[model samples]
Target chain A: MTATSFHFGEGDRTLYGVYHAPSVRRRRPLAVLLLNPFGEEAIRSYRVQKIIAERLAALGAAVLRFDYYGAGDSAGECVETSIDGMQTDILTAHEELIDLSNIRRVAWCGLGLAVPVALSAFSSANVNLAKFLGWDPVISGSEYIDDLTASHAKYLADALDMPERRIRRELSMQLTEVMGFGVSESLISDVVDLELNGSDLDVCDDVALIGRKSSGAFRKLHGQLTSTASSVSIEFDESVTWNSHQALNSIIVPNDSIAAIVRALADGDE
Target chain B: MNERIVQFGDDGRLSGVWNTQRKNSNRPTILLTNAGIIHRIGAHRLNVKLARRLADIGFDSLRFDLSGLGESAPAAGALGYERQSAQDISAAADFLEENGRSDSVIGIGMCSGADNFQRAALADHRLSGLVLLDPHAFPALGAAIENMINRYLDPYRWARKFSELKLNAKTLSLRTVRSKSEFSEYGGDTDEQGRLRPPKAEFGNELRTLTKRGVEIGIFYTAYVQREITRATQFFQTFSDYQLEGKVTVNVNPRVTHTYTTLQSQNMLLTEIETWLKQRFTD
Candidate 1:
């Protein structure tokens, strides 16, 4: 599987992406647009997304994995990033992939909070979409932010909280930087607004939300999606835990998760 | 200053983001690679911070994936991981030279990344300097014995250590050994006691050779390695007949970890690196 790294979008704020092209002999009907988790989780999930792209490419379809604007290798600063700006990046990446390959049919595989990003990207766009695959989909933006806060707390607990935090002035912040990514005041407001909309993944028919059974939130989300949308649970032999402060530096495959992604992408093979 | 994604090397399989400033004199370039499998962001976006900060100071930097790591495709050659990584580094440097990006380059890596860069710097004449962070650990008997004795005397420290280990053990039990990078993190449950000594004889030889060649070298050792080797003197002592005082800059910081996890730690590392580059590589 061959992958090419390129920048897309118009002048100013060009985004970085790794596009895995189809095999030599033949190509499938679908190409995947892999959206990443927000903040540091995107960095943690970089390897995972690349592997998924390669596997999909190996199976005869092309896949494009991109960094949201103002994040990763993408242009712009973290503080300048907004939910709307990132959604525009997703739409831009979607169009660029289609133009690059001249293949109309596209699928999505969003991880964690990025599931919402995928939904919002194709929400209004009239694109040839086949499958909607979300792994450990964050039910709502507020819930995800809450979990992020909890993760931040856990990180502090796990780490030797630096004594340097004792600054002269109060730690009054207009925004809190999650992990290493700076979450701007506008972005926080945007996320809260997203949460208020609920976990309605308004999209085309095919939907598969895979979540580790161990997570109570995931179990609830699975039930909600199955009842509300054309969603099904993609199960693995063993449950996976993708959210841990320890995962920041490590590269993990989550075999079951990959297998689930393969099954989801292979659905529209015809 | 401009930052853009660059597809460098032969056949364009290698990928990197170039952060450059319009230059007249050739400033020393910072060559950054993934720390093990951690990717070009370094531990806690240290490389990104370093690159952008370097750009502010008019120094160019290209942080890229080494062959199969991160976004770069895997190398097809029969070369091992280390050699492939070294070749990737050389390819990046060649790109810089060809494009008139910079005439001088300084390689930076930590842990195994440092090992590969050091191996390449010893061989590659294009490398003007290196910033080795927690490069390698060897048994420094004096430091090891001193730490053990300190632990023996400080019962409260021992208790805290025991408690930390217990909590860590719980997390360790859940994690499966998946990748070679992850495997190296554990060190294979081997007895690491008295392991920090004189670094391999070759490391010292390379240091002496690089210093003689007028290559500015700045090495940072975290408390993790410092506890074992103790002080900067042990490094010179490791390689006898090599008086590196003023010849090389060796910082033994007992506050930082191998991977700077905290914001303060990351800031301190960046500041030290910038200071070193300003003093050592300035024309």
Candidate 2:
């Protein structure tokens, strides 16, 4: 697999992306667009994304992984990141994947926070998606916000060795940043409004949701997708933790998860 | 500021973003490397901010990922990571010089990036200045005393220390908490990802050589878990015989985390580095 890094998008909103070209040409060209999660999760999950892209490329699927305008090595600041912007980024990336690969069949694998963006984009995008895969999908936006808040508090307390009272005091202030990355209020409001339901999954022909382990959110999302989706598959891999302090700094290569994703993307490949 | 994506180095495997001033100038290019495994964007997009900041001050900066990290493809060779990193830094410098950007380069980084910056400076003469954040430091007498005093002054530390002492007494362990020598300079070293640290004396000699060679050095140490630099002047005081008075500048802040998790801390670092650059290089 050969990976090439470049910037793609319109003026002022140019985004950074890495295109992973397959080693050999397949009978029917297939491409996978990997959408990253929000803020700190994107940083933590970057290696796994790269690994999955490489693995998919090895199996003859061209993979394109990118950062939104306001994130990663892209052209904008973190404060500019929003749900609508990210949904647009997903569309832009999807178009880039098709243009770069010139392949009609393109599948998208959204990780964590990207799950909702991918689902939302599935309904609005002009191009037809071959399949949609969501890893550790966030079913409830309000609950995910709570999780982020709690995680940020825990990280601050543990990192600084602060008391619970001090932690509470720190969190009581207006939160413009989480962990280390800055987040916009508008983005927070947009994320808080997101709730995965059967409506979003109705447009997707093939939907697969994978999680580290089966949780309430997973079962709920799976049920919703199964109820309305044309075809749905759910799987679990317990090798990785996406939002833990212990796993944040480490470059995790969840072998089982990678294998599962590759199998899903290459299901119809010869 | 004008930003352009660059793919240089052998086989065009290296990837970086070049941020430059709108008007061309003969200023030294700043090369920012990867902070550990995080991409060229640095921790919390610090590198991107720093690059643009330098550009605002009429300086060009290239923040790139070393081989096998970020967008850079892994080299098909058996070279160790350290040597490969140094080579990559040299290659970045070469890219800048070849593009008629600048002949001299200022290397800036934090944590693992700082370590690599220092290592690359030793082998690459194109590096005119280095801004190191939380680089490797040997335990010094003053640092230990200052650390103890600071801990004693903390109200919560006493209770924590007492609990630790009680646990130690119950375990009957002679092992006192000390930074492990074999672990990485920043700690969390495992068999699969162990960090190689050079001896203090050897590192001191390297610093002496850099000072004699007239390389501008700014070493900033933060409250890292594995940091032994508890005092601001610990680097100079530890190697007092090296006479690094005019050659190096050291700043240690125990309140700041290794990655500068807060916005204020990030600003503090950027201001310190910017001030140091202005003072050292008036060109």
Please give the DockQ score of every candidate, comma-separated.
0.27, 0.48
* Candidate closest to the true structure, highest DockQ: 2
For all the models shown, what interface RMSD does each have? 3.6, 1.9
Clash number for candidate 1 = 8
Off by over 4 Å in 2: A226-230, A237-239, A246-249, A268-270, B22-25, B150-155, B158-196, B225-227
TM-score of each: 0.84, 0.90
Q: What would the DockQ be for model 2?
A: 0.48
**Count of backbone clashes, every candidate in sequence:** 8, 0
* lDDT at B155, model 1: 64
lDDT of candidates 1 onward, in order: 0.73, 0.78
- Candidate 1 chain B, which ten residues in sequence have the lowest lDDT sum? B189-198
Instruction: For candidate 2, give the lDDT.
Output: 0.78
